[model samples]
Target: MKAEKDKIVSLHYTLTDDGGVTLDSSRGREPLSYLHGHGNIIRGLEAALEGNEAGFSSSVQVVPADGYGEYNPQAVFEVPREQFPPNETIQVGMQVQGESPDGVLNFTVLAVNEKGVVLDANHPMAGKNLNFEVEVLEVRDATAQELSHGHVHPHGHDH
Candidate 1:
């Protein structure tokens, strides 16, 4: 079967940045599986996978807009240190979840000072172009339950 809306796809991929730094990979692990055209993956990669069949392999480049999205400087802000639980340690690179106008947002700590903590709400991969080397291992029609649940169900299991 070909990858399309509501189909299930399994693929192995190695993701890298523009500088060729390895960002992620499915090597040495099970191939990633997701429902196609349902926003289970990035827009660019999903678009590229459209109409592809199992055993297909290719390298796809995805821009920030189609990936994690362009970085927003306005997403960085400082919050009073006391806002956090007193027992928690405030450290750089730590992720903290908080409520925002749009909904729950995850923020990364950029800096912590005596007065306040600087946080960035941008996704970790925001602003970077991504390169993906993909090999499609399987493609099949999604089960009615899988489609209803918005994800793939492992073999031998029913939900």
Candidate 2:
């Protein structure tokens, strides 16, 4: 089967950054499976995998735009410490969620002091190019339930 819309594609991948640092890998773990043509995987990687079949192996480079997206400096802002839970220990690198007009917003604490707390809402991988070495292991038609859910359902799943 070919990796295409409504198909389940299973693959093992090693992801790296521009500096050759290993970001993630499927070695010693179950190969990742996702529904093709959905938003289950990064856009660039999904695009690269389209039309491929099992046993295909290739290296793909995905720019920030096609991955997490470009980092926006404006996404970083400051809010009063009182906005957080009173008992919560606000610290650098801590992640927090807040409500916005758009919906729930995730922020990473950048700084904490008497002045205020600095938070950055940009995704951690934003602005970084993703390098992926992938080996396609299997490709098959997605189950009807998976198509309806817009994702791949695990084997022996209830849903």
Candidate 3:
């Protein structure tokens, strides 16, 4: 059946950044399944899936405004390294939750120094265009429980 509101749609997708680096993919594995028009995927991709059918393959580019969002310089800051537990092996690429001017936020450790640490709060993919290659694998009516739960229910699921 054609994908539409409340339908359960399964698709294999490869999500990449503007740099053409693979960010995520559904291959050699189960196709991602979710209730159509249920905010189960990125807005741009979800909109593109509307009215599509099984075996439909296409590519879509999602802008920061629609994907994650632009990077805010104000979100990155250097803070006293002492705040983190000593001997914790502070290292680049590690993630640490910290309190920011706005609220608690997740920050990726960009650098570490005796004076402080560099934290970037922007999403790893923020400020970039996201490219998505999608192939619809299946589309069928969603079970009542799937609609109620706002997700796809496995075959013969209790719900």
Candidate 4:
């Protein structure tokens, strides 16, 4: 089978940045599986995998716009220290979640001080080009449940 819409594609991938630093990998772990053409992975990688069959291997470069998206300066701001839980220690690089008009927003603490904490809402990888070394391990028709859920469901699992 080939990777296409509604199909389940399993692959082992090593993701790196333009600097060639590995950001993630599936080696030594169970192959990652996702429903193809369902926004389950980065757009560029997904597009590149289209029509590929099991055992296909390739290196794909994805721009920031197609990967995590360009960094937004407006996403960085300072919030008063009191906004965080009183018992929690605010530290740089800590991930924090808060309610926003659109929904819950996750931000990374860039700095901490007496008055406020600086947080950046951009994804950690935002603005960086992503390079992926991928090997497709399996391709098969997605189960009806998996299609309905918009994700892959492993055997004997409810979610």
Candidate 5:
């Protein structure tokens, strides 16, 4: 059956960046499955998979706006390491959840120094063009249980 909103969709996908770096793939494994139109995948990908049938394959380029989002310059900040819990080891490239006056946010450590740590709140995929090679393996109407639970169950079994 063709994929439709609220149905179950299963697909194998290979994702890459503009530089041709392989970001992720579903090869040599079970195809990923999820409920359609439930925010289970990126917006651009979900739109591409809509109405697709089993065995359909396509390549698509997803822009920053639809993939992750444009990098926000204001999300970068420098704060003293002492501001964190005593047990935490602050290091560059490490990801941490920071609680601000605004709200809790996930940020990546870009640089570290004796004076402070530099953190960036932008998502890793932000500001990048994504390329996807997707193949629809199956499309089926979602079960009543799955619809009620707001997710697709594997093999139509209870989750």
Candidate 6:
């Protein structure tokens, strides 16, 4: 079957940055599987894989907007140190999570000082181009259960 909405696609991919630094990959592990057109993957990658069938292989470049989105300065803010666990030692570059009105937000620590802690909610990959070398290993129609769940289940449904 071709990769389209509701189709499950299994693929091996090596993700890299513009400078060719490897970021992530499925080389030594099982191929990643996801339901097509379900937003399970990035927009640019889904667009590139659209209408393709199994056995397809290609290198795709995804801009920031299509990948993680351009970094928004508004997402960076400072919060009083008391917001975090008093016992926790906050450090720069460490990832943390905060509860917001919308939902839980993941943030990276930008700076920590006596005044407050600076956190950036933007994804770590935001504002950067992503390079993907992908090989589609298999493609098939998603089962009714998979479609209902909006994602692929590599193992039998246990959730």
Clashes of each: 0, 0, 0, 0, 0, 0
Compose the digit string of candidate 5's lDDT tens values, residues 1-159.
Answer: 988888899999999999899999999988899999888888988998888899999999999999899989998999987988777788889999977799998999999887888999999999999899999999988889988998988876765
Which tens-of-lDDT digit does each residue in 77-149 have in candidate 1? 9999999888899899999999969999999999999889999999999999999999999999899998888
Where does candidate 5 stray beyond 4 Å? 100-104, 155-159
TM-scores, each model vs. reference: 0.94, 0.95, 0.86, 0.96, 0.90, 0.97
Stretches off by above 4 angstroms in model 2 are none
14-80 in candidate 3: lDDT tens per residue?
Answer: 9887788898999888889988887887777888889999999999998888877888989888999
Q: After best superposition, candidate 4 residue 103: deviation in angstroms?
A: 2.4
Query: Per-residue alpha-carbon lDDT of model 4 for 22-73, expressed as tens digits?
Result: 9999999999999999998999999999999998999999999999999999
TM-score, cand. 4: 0.96
lDDT tens per residue, model 6, 1-159: 889999999999999999999999999999999999999999999999999988999999999999999989999999999888889999999999988799998999999998789999999999999999999999998998898888899986757
- TM-score head-to-head 1 vs 3, winner: 1
Candidate 4 residue pairs in clash (backbone atoms < 3 Å): none
Residue 77 miss distance in model 6 (angstroms): 1.2
Assess candidate 6 and give its lDDT.
0.95
Residue-wise lDDT of candidate 2 within 1-159, one digit each (tens)? Answer: 899999999999999999999999998899999999998999999999999999999999999999999999999999998887788899999999999899998999999997789999999899999999999999999888888889887674765
lDDT of each: 0.94, 0.94, 0.87, 0.93, 0.90, 0.95
Clash total of candidate 3: 0
Question: Who is ahead in TM-score, 2 or 4?
Answer: 4
* Model 6: pairs clashing at backbone N, Cα or C within 3 Å: none
